[model samples]
Each structure stands twice: as C-alpha cells, then as structure tokens.
Target chain A: MIRIFDIAAKDLMQILRDRKTFLFLLIMPIAFTFLFGFAFGGFSKGVSDPRLPVAIINQDGGDLSLRLVNLLENSEVITITQDAAKTLADYEKLLTKGNLAGILIIPTGYTDALLTGSLPPLSLEANITQTAGTTIQSEILAAANRLTSAVQTALIVGQTSSAFGPAFEQALSAWDNPPIRIESTSAVVQTGPKVSSQVAALAQTSPAMMLQFAIAGLLTCGAVIVNERKTRSLQRLLTTATRRSHILLGHYLAIFVLLFAQFLVLMTFGQLFLKVDYFRQPAATLLVAVASSLCIAALGLLIGVFAKNEEQAIAFSLIPMFLFSGLGGAWTPLEYTSATFQAIGHVTPVAWAMDGFKNITVRLLGFESVLVPCAALAGYAVLFFLLAAWRFRRVSE
Target chain B: MLQNAIEVKNLHKAFGDLKAVDGVSFEVAQGEIFSLLGPNGAGKTTTISMLSCLLRPDEGDALVMGHSIKDDQMGVKSVLGVVPQEIALYNDLSARENLTFWGKMYGLRGPALRSRVDEVLEIIGLTERAKDRVGKYSGGMKRRVNIGVALLHKPQVIYMDEPTVGIDPQSRRNILDSVVALKNQGMTVLYTTHYMEEAQELSDHIAIMDIGKVIAYGTNAELVKIVGQMDRITLTINAESGRVLEAWKKVQGVKQVTAQDGTLTVLADDSNQVLPRLFETSALNGVRITTVAIQEPNLEAVFLHLTGKALRD
Candidate 1:
C-alpha cells in the first residue's frame, strides 16, 4: 500500500509538473465549455423560429390581392419587401449576391380568381440558385400552402353555416360544404412543469459537459504515458521495485484525479455563477462525475497501451472521444437526433455518463439512479487497467 | 563462501531461435566492479538484464544477495539498483524530486528520505541545480541524476548498463569517478560496456563476451598475460634501412619486418631473441641503427590476440 501511494504520488507530481497536462486538465475544459455553450447554444435555439426575408412583386391592382399581401406581412414568419422595380431578373442578381432569400410574384389575375371562384394555378417563384435559397423558397411555399388551406376551410364553413354566409357568398358561396365539420381547436398542452431558464441552462451545462471537458485531459494522459515509454522512463522504473501494475495504476489514478479536479471546477462554476442545483443532491452529481472520469481515464489508458507513440495516441484518442461525445449528446441533445443514432450512442460510456448526469441534474435523482452507469464505468476501469498492465509488462520485458 | 554479492549459474535465455545468453555463469564478489565487455549484439545486455530481474532467464539460478531472482524476485529487486543506458530521469521533475520519488519507492520517508536526497545531490555535485527541472539540465547533469536515482535506496548491488554511452568526455570521467567512489563505499557493481578501455580502467574482474558467451574472463593482468610473451619492436636505422630490413627478414623467429623512411618495424613473437639477432644481422650488413623501442601490450592488443579483431571493430 505504501508503494502504491508512492507510485500514485509520483504520477501526480509528474502530471503537475507537465505544463501541457496541467493546461489540458484544468484550463482547456473551462475554455471549451464557454466556447461551445454560448456559440452553438444560441444557434440551436434560434432554429425553431422560422423567419425568412421575402420580396413580393404584386402586379395585380385588386383589393383581394392586396389583402393576401397584408395577411402574409402580418404573419411573424415573412418579412415582405416593398421595392417595386426589383424585377425577377433583379431579384435573381440580388440572390446571387446573397441579398435575398427568394421572390414572390403575384400575377395580374390573382384577385379575379379569389372573387369569381375561378382560381388559376398561381405560381410562387423563388430563387433556387443555392441549396439554402431553395430550402427558404420551399418554406415560403409551405407558408403559402397553409394560407390556402385556411381559405378553403373558411369558404366551406361559410357555405354550410348561414351566419358567415354573406361574407363568404360575397367571396365564394358556389363551393360545396364539406361532409365533415373539422373543428380545429388549438390546445397548448404543457409538456411538464415549466423549469426556470437558469435551471434549464444549468441542465445544459451539466456534469456530462464537464466529462466532455475532462476527455481532452484524458488524451493528455495518454500522451504522457506514451512519452514516458518512448523516453524509457518507464523502463527505468521497471528496474526498481516498481512493478508494471504500479506504473499503470499510478498513471490511471493521476488522470482520474486531474479529471476529478476539472469536474469539481465545472461544478463550482455551475453552482456559483450558473446557479446549478448541485447542493440539493451533491452525492448524485459527485458520483456521476467520479464515474465519468474513471471511464475516460480508462479509455486513455487503453489508447496509451495500444498507440505506438504520442502522436498516434493523440490522433487515435480524438476520434473515439469526439464520436462518443457527439453521439452521447455532449454536442447536442440526443432527442433532437434520430432515434436510431441515439440507440447506437447508448453503447458508448459517454451515453451512460450523460444519462446519469441528466438524472442527477434534470430528474433530481439519487445515487441509486446512477448505479448502473457507475458500475459499468468501474468495470471499464478494471478491464482497461488490466490490459494496460499486461501490455506494460510485455513491452518492458 | 567468497561472499558473492551476485551469483548466476548457467543462465540460458533465448528469444525464439536466437540464444540471447547461452549457458553463461559468473559471480561478482562484494565491493568489486565486475564488467561484461562485448561488441553490439554480444549478449552482455541480456545477461545483465536477467541478473537485474528485468527479464526472466529460461534456464538459470540467479542469486542476488542470496535471494533467487527467479523465485524471490521482489527480494532481489529490493536489494538491487539499476542505472539504464538511456538517461531515465523525468524531464519535467527536478533532480531533488526525482531522487525523493525513487527514495520513497524504496520505502524511505520523512527526514530519512530528505537527507538521502540531499546526500545524493551533493554526491553527484548537483546540489546547486537540485531545484532546477531535469529537462533544463545538461546531458552530464541528467546522467548524474540518473545514477543518483539508482543510489537513492543504497542497494547492495548496482547495475550500470552503458551509462556513458553518449556523454561528453568530462562527464564520462565524472561517471567513472562516481563508480569508483561507490566501490570504495563498499557497493558491488555489475558494469557492462563495449569499450575495452573503460573495462580495464574500472573493472576488477572483466568477462570478455562475444556471441552470447564469455569467451574469456579474468583480471586485467591475467588476460594481458595471454599475449605478454609476444611483443613488437620498431628500430629506426639512420643508414640504408632496406638492407637491415632484408637481414631482419632472414633471421629466424622474425615473423615479419618492413623498412621504410630509414626505419625498421619488426613483428616477432620473442622480442629479446629477435632484438639481439637483428643487431648481429645489422652489424654484418653494416646497417647503423638509430633508435629501438619495445611496445607493451594493452587490453586492445590482448583482445586482438584472442579474437583476431580490434576492439572497436
């Protein structure tokens, strides 16, 4: 046990002495957390609001056509342009320069169709030059489709009900009433109790984010081990009373400590500045952090054992870590992705960590809720440590 | 019992089809510097590695301080120190920290560890630079710290494997002085080197190894005695030396002779007999001899006589 303590101490000392390790384990994570959370967070939330800039060229001089333009302008989605000289060709040139998303050309006979109930097929032209322009044009067409559906439904309702008849008869009473009265009622069902914006923000910046932050440090741990091996420092230790297990255990413990410290820093930041509810259930959060760190540390050891050198270790560790973080909802919520990808992500330890962290922060769960992920992480630690020990012994021998 | 600090009997180690150390055996007495001298790929490293308990011998009994390296490996390891060929000190750590960490590994702690670290730092003459990180150190300083780590535990037997491989001349001399100092303090050493001069300078007992076997093993004086009877004499004759060279070639036991630039260089197994005979031949030939010098044999000459190849080759 004293030997183990000595080994662990030496490992910690080496990590503390290394400036790169210190920076990665402590500083890099904090920087990434702020960089990713603010930059991408706003973009992700803004995607839900479908706002598009559209130029409408109305050649018709009728009240019905003018009313349609007012209806489009009144909706929160479309921002109508009022430049009359902007022809279709001019609009195309503006779109090429990224000045316009699309153009809406309302032909001369649009109001005649509405008033006489002899509607011609109205064309909604858009700039389909770029993919994004085409997508925006499709969105505008979809909005126009919604308006047409509403008009058709109102005309049928007015034909059947005498109360709204004259207004519709003045509009379109020749149309037959639909067999079914499709009474559309808009009901706002609450998904759950409304969480505070701060709590939701804290949930977004939970321990899983801390774990993702810790993974860069874990890669540094791999580089450290590989560097030691390449430089023959580990070989020198083998000549001492230190066994292969001691070296591996020492490094593993060192990385775990560094990662744990990083998690603590994130938690502290969350509690103080972000107002995260960690104190309400500290044990659960701590367990999640500890388990996640162990898993990542083991992953680092595995990479160190297999990689031929430090460069290979860094490159190899990045792929799995980035992939796992992406799949496990570190970059974005898994619910926003396809169900199949979410199921595939569940196989990764990051998925388990994210699940455990969400249970702790969002569900207000206890340690029992995170027992499985904790056990799985522990099992990974044991397996990786054993493999690293075996490899170290073989290589040294 | 001669009080052998390290004993190996018929050690056999093989890597697949290659016999790394083939049935070799030797012992180093307490407080002696024993050397394994060989060229590259000569199995000196494999032998020392096994005795150091870094590698397991396929067939052998290695007893370090009366502990079997095969069975009681932990005990063997506890009493042994190893200074590797490559400088193994951590670059990120200070010299003092490296020593302390190694000392702690040997179960030393508190004041004892601190004092030992201080003593080693002073011994290596790096006390002033002890606080500086090893990465900032020169090659010589790093080499000193590497030896300091091995000495931290004060083990009975220390193995130095090519410790002066790439250091400067001054640092190599310093390392040699440190080895001598350790031996004077009664520390047994197993030193391996390819340089014959280093072996002759430091080792009390030298085992000349080649191709996974010790071809010859003895004291420096004893090993040199193999070719001690045979010596070369070079004669500088002021008069026409070609005549003297012709006369010297005809003389019996004069294996070879060459005269160039008014000098005669002779190769003979018996210098005493050849010298007198050459004088007589020169007198009869009327060749005037200017200077005659006899060269004493060194380890290089001894190695050449034994293996028919130069030490460096």
Candidate 2:
C-alpha cells in the first residue's frame, strides 16, 4: 500500500516536471473554452437581449394571431418560436429542463378582439415562482403595452377606412413591418426546447473542452507507463518488494490525480472567469468529475497497457480522444442534434460525463440527475480498468 | 558446507519453443560473486529474471535467503536487487529522487529512505550531481544512477546483469571496483556478462551458458583446466579469415581454430608445435599473419575448447 502511493507520487512528480502536461491539461482547455464560449455567445456580455425562450401554439392561425406571433418574434425581451406540436405540457417540460422560460398561446378569439381595436387576452404561461419566469412577466407586460399602442393606432385608422377589418389588418401589418425598415442587426433569438442561453455560454463549452482535453492529457499521463516499460523501470520495480497489483493501482491513482486535477482547474476557470454555474451544485459536480476522471484514467491505463512505446501510446490516446470527443458531444452538445446521433453519442463515456454535468448546470437538476451519468462513467471505468489489468497480465506473462 | 545465499534447482523457462532458460542450476555462497557468462541470447538475463521473480520459471525453482521464488516472489524480490542491462532509472527524476522512489518500493520509508538515498548517492560517486535529472547526466553517470537505485535497499543477493556493459573504461573500472566493495560488505553478487575478462576477473564460481543451458560451472582455475595446459594463439592476418580457416583446421597440434572480428584464434596443446604449421598453412593460403600472441589457458580457451567456438559466439 505504501508502495502504491510511492509509485503514484513518483509518477506525479515526473508528470508535473513535464511542461507539456500543463499545456494540455490547463492552458489548451481554458483557451478552447473561452474561444468556444465567445463563438456561441456563451459568455454573459457576449449577448444582448438574450430573450427568455418561449414557444407559441397557434390555436388560432388568423391574421392577427400571425401578426402577434411576428410581433413577439421581434420582442426585445422574449424570443418566440412557433411549434404546432409544443403543447402546454411540452412548455412545462422545457421550463423544467431550463430550456423554455415561458409559453404563449394565441387562442381563436385573438383576431376578433383585435378587430374591435382592444387588447386581446393572450395567455403567457410561466412559473411565476422562478426568477426567469418573473422577468418574463415584465417583458410580457411591455409586449402587451405595444399591442395596446397598435390597437389605438388601428382604432384611429378605422375611422378613415370605414371598415374595422381592413383597418385592423393595416395596423397589425404596420406594427410588424414598420414604415421605415430599420434593419438593425441583432443577436439571433434562440428559442424552443434547448439549453437556456445563460447556461449555454460557458456551461456547454467548458465541460466539452474539459472532457476533450482530459483525454488529450492522457497522451502525457499514459506515456508514463510507456516510458517505464521502455526504460525498463517497470521490470526493475517488479524486482522490488512491490507486487504487480500495487504497481497498477499506483499508476491508476496517478492518472486519476492528473485528470481530476485538470477537471478542477478547468472548472475553476469556467466558474471564476467564465461565470459557469458548476459550483451551484458542488457535490454533484464533484460526483461527475470523480467518475469521469476514473473512466478517463482507466482509459489511459488501457492505452498504456497496449501501446508498445510512447509514440504508440500517443496514437492510442489521440485516436480515442477524437472518437470519444466527437461521438460524445464534447465538441457539441448531444442535444439539438438528431436522435440517432444522441444515441450514438452516449456510446462514449464523455457523452455521459457531459450529460451528468449539463444536467446540473444547463438542465438545473439536483444531485439526483447526475446519478445515472456517474454510474455509467463508473461502469466504463471498471470495464476499461479490467481490460487494462487483463492486458497488463498478458504483457507481463 | 558454507551457507549459500542463493540456491537453485533445475529452473527452466521457454518463450514458445525457444527454451530461453533451460534446466539451469547454480548456487551463490554468501559474500561471493557468482557470474553467469554468456553471449547474447544465452539467457543470462532470463535466468536473472527468474531468480529475481520478474518472470516465473516454467519448471523447478530458486530460493533467495531460503524463500522459494515460485511460492514467495515477494520474498525473493525483497532479498534481491536487479540492475538490468538497460538503464532503468527514471530519466525525468534526479538520481536522489530515483533512489528514494525505488527505496520506497523496497519498503524503506521516512528518514531511512532519505538516508539510504544519500548513502547510495555517495556509493555511486554521484553525490555532487545527485540532484541533476538522470536524463541530463552523461551515459556513465546515468549508468551509475541505474546501479545506485538497486543499492537503496541493500538486498542480500544483488543481480547485476551486464552492469559494466557499454561504458567507458574509467566508468567500467569504477563499477567493477564498486561491485567488489559490495562483496566485501558481505553481499552476494550474481553478475552476468558476455565479457570473459570480467567473468574471469570477478567470479568465485562461473557458469557459462549457451542456448539456454549451462555448459560449464566451476571456479576460474578449474574451468581453465578443462583446456588442459592448452595455449590460445591469437593471430591478426592481412588476408581474410575465410581463406585460411580450413587449411589451419587441418594443421597438426591445432585443437580448434576460430576466426572472428578480423582475428584468428588457434587452441593448441603446444604453441611451439602448432605455430609453425599454422604459419605454413597461412603462407600457403597467401595469408600474412599480422600479429600473434600465445597466452596460457583462460576462460576464452575453456569456452573455445569445450564449445568449439568463441565465448563471444
């Protein structure tokens, strides 16, 4: 047992001495997180009027309803998306998932009420208890005021037109498409069942970059084993009082330390500088971090066990990094992608690690949400570790 | 009988059908140096590995400090320190750090490990540069650190497998002297080398192996007597060896003739009787003998006389 720690300490010393470890583990990941975060408008100041996402079900596909939809689309506060299949239940689900901030319903009487040149009753649904929901309420009031302005303008136009029908159509059309087309560029309004813009900024990219570079860092960590074999230190160690199991456990512990430390550093960068909400659920974050570290370390072990040299170890590490990161949604969230893609993405432990982390941050779930992902990651860790152990035994033989 | 520090039965190992260490047996007495001399692929390292418990034997077993290698590998490992042919120290770590780490692996801890590391640094004569990374050290310095790592635990039986291989003469002298110093401190040494001079100079008992089996085992004098007063006549010729080898083989009084590395060696019961015939044969074959030395029976001649080949072969 002491020998195990001795081995781990020695490996960590070697790994720390390597400047490349720092580059891969900290510098590269942080740089990519910032880059991807800015690219996706993931940072707080990177976006303006990051409107609360909401979906509209056009139960009334009338002219005024369409105008109202278009009017809400231009809302500086709330981004509106039309989804015929998005029921109130879907709205609730999205809200719980931290995707939709609210839901709007344009009922059948909306166009008729606009004909009378008055404020029509539009059902804006949101959980008032939540902060986002409260913010949405104020935005909804502002949109309602705009509607009243349009109605009064239509009332005055109705007198000259002699017909309420043409007047209402003209007023709503003018409201939606203004007289002077001031085509001011604005940030694209992301709506529907997706991660909230607040969460999407650093939440997605930080974890994605963390998981990706964690595997990338394996190139350095796994090379420790390859170097040992090449230098014959491993055989020398076997000639000591230490057992083979001690050696394996020691190496595994060291790899886990390297990967987990990387996670902590990258997460700290995301939390402190990027304003990612990893610490909102610190224990849950740690659960996934440890599990993911275990899986990645075991993967490094397997690579080390099979690779004949440092170059081979690097190839093994890189190939899996590309495969796992691409397949696991480290470069992109599995969400918003095709269902088949999401299914395939989960084949990699990175996807599950991302799932576990996003569940806490993007989805705003509690500790319970990360349990499945942690379990899956642990299962992968066990499988990879067992494979490494078996292969190590064969190589030793 | 003197108590032996290491005892071996018919230890054997095979990589498929290669029989890397086949039915080999030897014993090392306390405070003595036992050498396993063989050429490449002669299984010296394999035999050392089996004794060190780095590899399990396919048949039979060895005991180090009365612990069976098969039944108690950890016991054998605890008693043994192996310096492999390759420099096995972590190049990224300093000599002190490498020794400290191996010490810990050998179950040394706290002040004991630290002092042992410092002591080993002194012993290997690298105390001043102990803090420098092994990778930055010269090849000889790295080799010294490699040997230093094995001395951290002060095991009862130390296996130095070709420790002096591939080093400058000065460093090789330092290592050979350090090895003698270890034996003087009452440590048993199992040294392996292909260099017959090293074996002849160091071994109290020498085991010469070829193709996985020990062909001879005895003290230096005893093994040399197998050549029975034969003298080794080494001649460097101007002509190629392949041209004169067959003619020299038929010469009277020439026991065995082997040509290697631009030099020809002739074993004869009497150098006076064979020197003339060998010259006549070489002259007839249009070969000019450049240099000649007739030396007394040695391990090389024992190897040549017994195996009909050079020890280097």
TM-score of chain B of 2: 0.94
In CAPRI terms, model 1 is classed as acceptable
Q: Docking quality tier of candidate 2?
A: medium
Q: For all candidates listed, what's the TM-score of chain B alone?
A: 0.81, 0.94
**How many clashes show up in model 2?**
1
Local distance difference test scores for all models = 0.72, 0.81
User: What DockQ number belongs to candidate 2?
Assistant: 0.59
Give the TM-scores of the predictions, in the order they appear. 0.71, 0.80
Question: In candidate 2, which residue pairs clash?
Answer: A42-A201
Candidate 2 segments whose C-alpha is farther than 4 A from its true place: A44-198, B238-250, B260-262, B284-287
lDDT of 2 by residue, B50-99 (tens): 88888889999888989999998877887888889999988999888888
Which candidate comes out best when scored by DockQ? Answer: 2
- Report the C-alpha lDDT of model 2 over A223-339, residue by residue, as the tens digit: 899899888888888787777888999999999998988899888888888777899899999999999999999999999889998898889989998999999988876655554
The segments of candidate 1 whose C-alpha lies over 4 angstroms from its true place after superposition are A39-202, A205-208, B232-295
